[model samples]
Target: MEKKYPRLQIAKYVAADYFSAMVSWILFYTFRKKIIVAPLYDSVGQDLNDPTLIMGIVIIPLFWLLIYYLSGEYHNIYKKSRLQELGRTIFITTLGVIIIFFILILDDTIISYKNYYQSFLFLWGVHFSLTYLPRLIFTTRTIHKLHNHIIGFPTLIIGSDEQALQLYNDLQKKPKSAGNQIVGFVTINGGPKTPLSNHIPHLGNLNNLIETINNQKIEEVIIAIEPSEREKIQQILTKTKATNVMIKAIPDLLNILSGSVKMSSLFGVPLIELSHELMPAWQENVKRVMDVVLSSVALVVLSPFLLVLAIGVKLSSKGPVIYSHERVGRFGKLFNIYKFRSMYTDAEINGPALSSKNDPRVTPFGRMMRKMRFDELPQFYNVLKGDMSIVGPRPERQYYIQQIVDKAPYYLLLFKVRPGITSWGQVKFGYAENVEEMIERLNYDIIYLENMSIYIDLKIMIYTIKTIMEASGK
Candidate 1:
């Protein structure tokens, strides 16, 4: 079984980093005080009793910890590759040293400019050495445990053919276990029992894929179906959209040449690791920070405008100032999305419906608000509430989501990310008046998902601003 305490492993690394940072800072301070300052000024003491030392001791370690967190060092601690981690440590350590030099060290009194260079190099070397040694030891211990089968991730094979059998055999026969404890196999097509059944139990098929993943606590999924069965591959991926499992598949020559596949283990069979996560961890965290900050500012800055709009809505039509509706969010969770009422109170008396240009249900003030998107102002609260982001795929009500899913099953993939106040779909395609248009808009959202980053988000926001200024959302 996998270690039940992954947090303990993370804490071990964090403790290592924090301890190393404190020690490195102290060493750098001593070097500055003794070699740099005391030699030049007799009044300067070599003792570590200064307020500067006290402050550095308190702040520098926390600063380094925050950098490590943003660098995503704590994620999937057991699955980290030591070689890759070494490279990452060197790069990040150099970058952090530069930052510290400018912010904390560069202005120090020095005998010559040579001291600055020496200080930078010494800090980088000391920090890197202290940080990497303990990390290397921890990682080596985890890898040794994995190789000895002392710990393993719960893995499931999503195929039942000869390819699946061969994959199972290859992984089981590997000189070192890739930590894949092949718990069972799931069938893709209905047929006779596969050869793999002799080794592992059949969990179920695609119909109950999500249920099986949840019930079995699956951490990794390997799709062993033939590459030629592209439809099956698509189907398997679609069903696993809501799962948090790491997905890998047997790759063809084309995929390899296209650089779509990456090696997860040197000792295990070659396979393409499919990544559903769209953005890097640092950018994802930064985006959330931006969402909170921007949304908070927007709500505060636009309060008077919001009040005016609320008054207009109440006077223009008979309904509450705010409108709320349940929408499907990330991981298929349901949350109430907020908006200023843009339609009459009984606009949807017949049933739920999508608004269109010149829709009779839309009040005169509502149409103008939709064109300028003032009605969406309240959704900043949703962003602040963590139900949405400032930029992402637009959320759809479950009523219309089911309709959209009927035509395009991949729509659920959008649920992998939080819905946003404005999206590439809204920027390019504007509001969708029908399910078909929503599907059409989904192409842009899907593209946005594949290429998500802070840069892409800023680009989308720029275009969304243009749309609002031009009143072109119609």
Candidate 2:
């Protein structure tokens, strides 16, 4: 039931951080007033109600909170590791202190630079100590509750053989709980013949997984199917890939030998947890922030350029300046993708088709626009609208998507994230002329998705710019 109270627990962390930040700032200010610049306070010691102090008390805590949030410290509050928390707190606090020093305290009227260093070190120490202490306390208490089974994720076990039974017993009887509350079990090959049915109730088969997960409020899924049933793993994974729950598979001898097994506790069942997310939480947050900011700025600054592009397309083509076409977006949701019209009217009257290098339907002006990526500039509006990202797997139309999925079932994984204006595929392989080339280009996008980080996005963008300059894309 504690899992159901996530917001309440999250509020506790935020509240603790807010007050700790406030107290740390107050203490730092007091030290500055009393020791660093004692002459300014007069012989009688000054009133503590200065406007600057009041402002710091109000705004500085918010500043620290913002720092913590952007550093990814406040996310997944219940799943925090104490050791990791300590390390992250120290790192983020140090960074925040440095930023604040440069921005605020560096301009202070200090007698010497030595005093500035002292003030900075003192403030950092106080802030780090105060902030980390409460976090450690809260995290420790939460971990204690988790270990004692007071707070646990609602996990579903998928398998009904001896392996699954043993895994269930091992996790259930462990000295320290792995925080998986086995709500029930699901059998991939039917539950009647399996020994697990004698113990836990079988919820349903893989056919009803999404519904079962939703109805049961499942948070995690443990895949412990036997080696003989390994073929079912792909089907299981495909079915569960779209669900938000964490997916973990039981490791085999090869996995153990390859060092794939990771145990959080001494007796906890080892699991090969699927990589939970593509990028660090902070990078994901920062990417979204950049998307909004950059798209907004581009829309404003490139207004004149967009206007000219629109006029050119209108004059050169017998169609609307902007083309709106349906494309599958994140989680298979369809959205209208906007682009400058790069083709004449009735270019796709036969059906949806990929453009070729020498397609006559593409106007000369349109080809120039494609070479310069001016056709995609309007997608900044799509990014601003949250229908697309600045960088991701380029979305495919349903007609092409069906063909791609038929050739490579894993293409469905691309739907997990928002489509981008420029992708690793587009940068590396350019526009695919056919389904076969599209499938070949799919590998790079998959690589990009697997190792998605800001660095990769920047690298793809650099390549895209080079491609545009070279006029190399098909």
Candidate 3:
């Protein structure tokens, strides 16, 4: 499926949905004109060719299309399930109906209150039927292709042990195809070899996993090692996390009985899907929107406050007011993060050090700025520049990050999100005075990642504000 006209495949979904919107709107308008509105006293004989009618036909469909795109309905078009598509379509269509009715049709001249409810129900029914039917047809075709072995995703197995061989054989012998066309397998530590190597070619060392993934265009990674090697799972993800490949693992009876496994494929096999995404697609997009809008407004609205702080920092210290430091961001990319100077010129001349409450390096005015959290204001520019977000695990310098990783290898997980100006860790545990303290704060950050949500972010922000107002930096 991915090999043939990949771009056109997604275009087909968009085209089908676009016409669905246009056709549904046309039917609803016709119903309103000929049945619902003609009985009204003033709305009789509404013109079908009016400028507004023509404009709406063009605009409404585009509006629906934008909504679908933002909802991420157009992504992974070939891999979608008809059942999931149906549910998503209903949800988005209902939202669309509410917006359209309020903005476009609430003021319409109607014979009675019944007309309002009737119009809404009619439009909603027409839209849902038209929209869902075509998508279901397209999705059905994709599924049929997969079952017939005409379409498959490139999958790589990450172990060569007994469990790997068992999974490989079961998948091959399954009556129905799961669409995982195995490209090859890799050994984690040259553990006891199995028939897996005889069946599929052994892709080289695990260290070369990324290169092999790119070269073979691997779409999936199935880890089938034993329970003792569970620690290796973290190492594999730390490397392959950047590849955007779907990762799954063979689950033991313990996991299945405990309801820890959420099945993704119902037919050929049962595996635990590893989804590390922090937010749903729509929420992720909205978070970026919030970051841009909020940062832009803060920079503009707080310009006076920022200017005064800049001069105060300059007079209190002999360093640039706006300090730029290189920090590791998402996917381990390094970028210069901006900050308002809160220390003397040679504060870090000896080496990188975490600040103590009474550190002499922090000038008197700098300490006050830290108390008010004013030192982080310049990072709004970083947020606007798309390098950081308003709420995420705080970023650390590479030297410090390396040390932190030594203590907590999962520290690298924080790199999954753009480092924020203030984080749940900063709010809950305050500043770290040493490596041990930083590791202690890591627990709160890990909690934030596991329970990430818009509401959680808002709560962290609220606590951060109260802390700043109280000059409560530790």
Candidate 4:
């Protein structure tokens, strides 16, 4: 069965990053060889070789990667915003070129000082243009897909009153090009005295938000509570503040008119402000492409280990080696998540149960596998299938999600994006032993969501690797 939070296609994203870097480097080299130096002196046109030339080509990309990571460019590859991404790309490219000029190109055998500035300009133009062009193309295609409904993030509305209904109606009337597609509404109070009940499914009360999000596969949550419920709103926000979902506030019409809203649109009806959607359309596309490429490579490279795990599972347990179970994904959709079975055939015969560190039902091999997260390898298939990501908030089961939402209404926010095989929470908190523990870890995930960036993802990845090497995950 397919998981609701399908893993991201990591291969595409890795390929994009690799190719873009290669192309940018090549362009820089060509410009230096064929344009800048060649035009300056006839003798210089002949073959000129520097030992560091090749190294510079290779090293430049390493620098770019470092800068990109520092700039938080790699996180959430699927949800980038084009404008912001372009701005970042330009900044990084310019910085890279300036550094290159002083380190590699400035002290060149130039006859005139004018040549120094010319060379710098040439390198910067070629590198930035080549790098950003491919990124733009890839991102544009993704935005198109989102608008065409070929791809959509599952969204949830957080309020049940008149304001919530107003926001829902406004979003529904928006042009198809709007990126979001609302799945359903989770009421904040007992039952909203609003028109939304007739238009959309009232998934459940606020107390069951996490459960509703898991069951419905929600991706984004729009908080449209009334102004009077400030205290209650804060409580809801506190609960949801931990997940990676997009949280947008429904501002009053005056706020919209006064330009306090960052993003808003008129859909032949009243206007609404979409407060948070951090990345640009293009960056999001680039991120997806990277995910697909990396995941594909990982699957191939780790095939041998996967085979061994399957064999081990077969020998260690009586049931099938691979276990598929329901999981909540982006937009509250349900999908079957794949994993190497880590427990006995009927480990949970009583019902859904959280595994303890020394659970008796676990197979001997399963214990080792859980420690190293080997049981999660098969999830790469989910990434390939576009149900999850390599990095994001980890998906949860409906049972525990309901439990979490009872105490934290904001747990519903996690439904805004695809779940991940590894997340900020997983890297920091590992596995949760119970509902309370899960809620505790939810803080890290929420922080990740609000401060999502490529740099943060790399840090998490590095930490995750460290955890795995030490067998620190529980």
Q: Best by lDDT, which number?
A: 1
1-474: candidate 4 lDDT, tens digit per residue: 112222353345445656666666666666666665666535533434544556665776677765565455665555666897789888878887788778878777766788788777767777777777767776787766666667777788777777877777676666664556677787765565457888877787767776776677666677777766655665655545445565566655334222124544423433344444544544555556667888899899999999999999999979999999999898667899999999999988899988888999999999999999899989989988999988889999998898998997667778766788899999888888899989998998888877766677678878877878998877
Q: TM-score for each prediction?
A: 0.88, 0.82, 0.80, 0.56
Tens-digit lDDT track of model 1 for 1-474: 546479888999899999999999999888777787776545545355678888998899999998888877887888887997899899989989999999988889888999999999889999999999999999898898888788999899988877899889899888898788888988877543778888999998888888888889899998887655556766677767666788887765234332134655537588878766678888887888899999999999999999999999999988798999998898777899999898889998999988888889888998999999999999999999999999999999889988888899989789889999999999989999999999999999999988899999999999988888999977
Error of 1 at 403 (Å): 2.5
Give the distance in Å from residue 240's predicted Cα in candidate 1 to where it truly belongs: 3.4
Query: Whole-model lDDT for model 2 versus the true structure?
Result: 0.83
Each candidate structure's count of clashing pairs:
0, 0, 0, 64
Best by TM-score: 1
lDDT of 3 at 122: 96
Measure candidate 1: CA RMSD: 3.1
Q: Give the clashing pairs for model 1.
A: none
Better of 3 and 4 by TM-score: 3
Give me the runs in candidate 1 sitting further than 4 Å from their true place.
Answer: 2-12, 39-51, 148-150, 226-231, 251-259, 307-320, 363-365
- The positional error of residue 282 in candidate 2, measured at the CA in angstroms, is 3.5
Q: Which ranges of candidate 4 are over 4 A from the true structure? A: 1-111, 119-297, 427-430, 447-456
Residue 371 of model 1: what lDDT?
91
